[model samples]
Target: MTSALLEQSVVETPSSFRVLTGDRPTGRLHLGHYFGTLHNRIRLQRLGVEVMLIIADYQVLTDRDLAERLPEHVEDLVLDYLAAGFDPGRGTVFAHSAVPALNQLLLPFLSLVSTAELSRNPTVKDEIAHSRQAAVSGLMFTYPAHQAADILFCKANLVPVGQDQLPHLELTRTIARRFNDRYGKVFPEPAPMLSAAPLLLGTDGTKMSKSRGNAISLSATADETARLIKGAKTDVERHITYEPQRRPEVSSLVLLASLCQDRDPHEVAEEIGSGGAAALKRTVTSAVNEFLAPIRARRTELARDRRYLRQVLRVGNARANEIADSTLAEVRRAMRTVY
Candidate 1:
């Protein structure tokens, strides 16, 4: 299907719909991220939706012990977005730290949510476990609130997310409803714009994650990507087939190839079936490298113009601040804090 068709199939919204989607700038984005959300974001922007891409730097602090590496991470993230076809002119791409209004809005939003409710957020619980934290810090425990603030600050009506993120979007809705009922209707109850894309697993046949070393970073060199795919674990079955339950390893490879080729996984499986595991690996490696070649080249070219990258973020920050200031003013007015 074409990108427009893919977008229309997943997103059912009006032409004036506004969307807010982002990533925590902890590291480079990967294929899992590309098929999972980035592609959808680009498609939505192309369709004339008001898209805001946030570099959630503060959210990274929930688990990261050091803030020193954040600048590098943030810059790399902007590069990935540019390479992935996210146009700053078409959509706002700003850092969370630069928008002080979001932080200001977070304080009042915290009161709208109860501690018991925060404790019940499954996404937060899952993140804490994944981070392997001995104990959840206050900031980490209350991250859902931060996320709620992120959504409401923009008055965003649509948030593109995967199945795992449904609970977080629900929390944002809950906060929006409670605040509107208690104070006034100041924010939209953001709905989840679920992607139709299949979840891409890591090369290790597990959930793709940067920390797990199973992920394929979009910024990885062609040789590095080939090496990773060659080393990827596959089933011992002689025939390549897509059987996710019985053969998750091989199915993950099929899934990767399908997404890269934009065809059905079964079709990819059939094409590579005759070659067995070795052939499947070679096909997957070639397909992935071919798909990433242009993206990587664009990223390399963009990385050289550091001045332009800085300007993009600066302009995005100013645009975000302008919208945020207007939203915060309305929120303050609703709460009788207009002074």
Candidate 2:
């Protein structure tokens, strides 16, 4: 799918389109993120497409009352993006707090979506259901509108997203179309550029997440990775097969190994046949450690220079503001709001 998308005339003309993607700096990104998104972002960047990444520091407050150690988490997100081969020279990564124009777009975009639509958003409902607080914030309820602002602020026409985030993007598209029909065409109806990479299961055979304590962070030490893999759940399947439905746990390890080694999952499974869980884990450990070695090294070097990281933020925020300001002006003109 990605190959097809990349080969399309529109994508070949990278200047014609821009991609908006982001992460909430709530915790460290994990293996699930690398396969699902980070790698795809890098691939797109290399293809000459313009990318804007938002470190959504504000949205972090929707569910939680406070964003603990907010600055540190924001820096870590940029670090992860850099270590994963996202070229800062070619892409933009900005903090939500730093870009006032971006947040200002939220108010107008909010009026474009209905409360009913917001309430039924599966992602929002799931999040609200799982929220730590007994009472929810209005920000949490209007999360999709905020996301629309994030995407539309730059007039970004493409968004790299997983299947789960499709609803949010669809709502954004709806808002864009509505705004254009109601006022004027100030935004593109964004499309989802889904990742071609297969979904990666966590070490525990369940959905990987940082809060769940089952994720293997990109920043994890080799020893930490090994230990985490060592404790992964697997059944008593000596002759390993890549039957995901039947042997998800063992196959997950084999999948990780295959990903690290850049080979087919089944091929990896066949090679490790009869190796059992222990042998499978060893394979994963070796492949993962070796693959992540360079990235970890880069992260180490980058993390040591806090000033450079801050500079990166400053550059990204400035770019975002420039784009957002232009879009807001256009929107104001469309709405006849200028005095």
Candidate 3:
């Protein structure tokens, strides 16, 4: 969908939109996730858009045996989501395994796409390269189809994704269009609500990731946040600047401060002129900690109540199943398999 069209839909028909967005329980979410998609999700849900969050527990197995202490990881993810102001009362947050009907949609979706197409998917190719797998797991290979089921089973029409994830969503759109052509119209072609923020680089001048040990987690304490920022990559140049293309590492730090301060990156750099990387790091540390303080407090408070967290998931799973069941019934009827 065009940017203009998406804007119109968000403003004019938010109630008509259902957004599918989630995280893998592989690790804790970080700044990349917060600015990348989580912030937009909270906005849409508050705007009355139906949001369905999948704590994709199954997807973790696609690359690894399983997430260690998997349930703890899932709860951590939910904590991060709630701490970031994602209201489960206004939307649904469920684990991927809980909704059997949703997984069932994978069968029909797989038939609509080819192995060659899945093989060519950039995201899948990247994962395979990093997974160090001698032979790809079937689940890993067919992840695109599984994701399509996640989106289409709830008939989600708006998917909040990073730019790198467009290929996966494009495949989902293709499956929806093909299903409509071959079986009948049973799904909406979901659109990408790309994050406005540029991708946040990690502290070590790489992609921000929990496994990489370069990320600042939402649950991180003030001291940990300070220590992580102290090790962030920066250039030797004394003058601070925000020229991303020419000085990415230094500029990334500047951008981090800007995001936390909610100011222009260039402006943030100007204020730190000649103070260099040390000054930048201190500023970033302060801004990050100050911004995340309340979020961490909420996270800590919420963590004590495991029962409330469980109840949230239980409610979300039941609601997600209802939608999944209804959508699957439509799929069967469209395929003349209701008998």
Best by TM-score: 3
Error of 1 at 181 (Å): 1.2
Q: Any idea what lDDT model 1 has?
A: 0.87
TM-score of each candidate structure, all chains considered together? 0.95, 0.97, 0.98
Task: Give the Cα error of residue 65 in candidate 3, in Å.
Answer: 2.3
Model 1's C-alpha root-mean-square deviation from the true structure amounts to 2.9
The alpha-carbon lDDT assigned to residue 52 of candidate 3 equals: 88
Steric clashes per prediction: 0, 0, 0
Q: Tell me the TM-score of model 2.
A: 0.97
lDDT tens digits, residues 1-339, model 1?
A: 444653564466546578898999988999999988998889888878888999999988787666658889899999999999999998889999999998898888899888988888998787788774566778888899999988889889888877888888898899999999999778888767767767677888888998789999999998898889888888767999999889989999888888888889999998887799889888888889999999999999999998888899999999999999998898889889976
How many Å off is the CA of 187 in candidate 2? 0.6
Better of 1 and 3 by lDDT: 3
- lDDT at 315 for candidate 3? 96
Candidate 3: residue 158 lDDT (0-100): 91
Tens-place lDDT per residue, model 3, 239-336, is 99999999998988888889989999999999999988888889999999999999999999999999999899999999999998999899999999
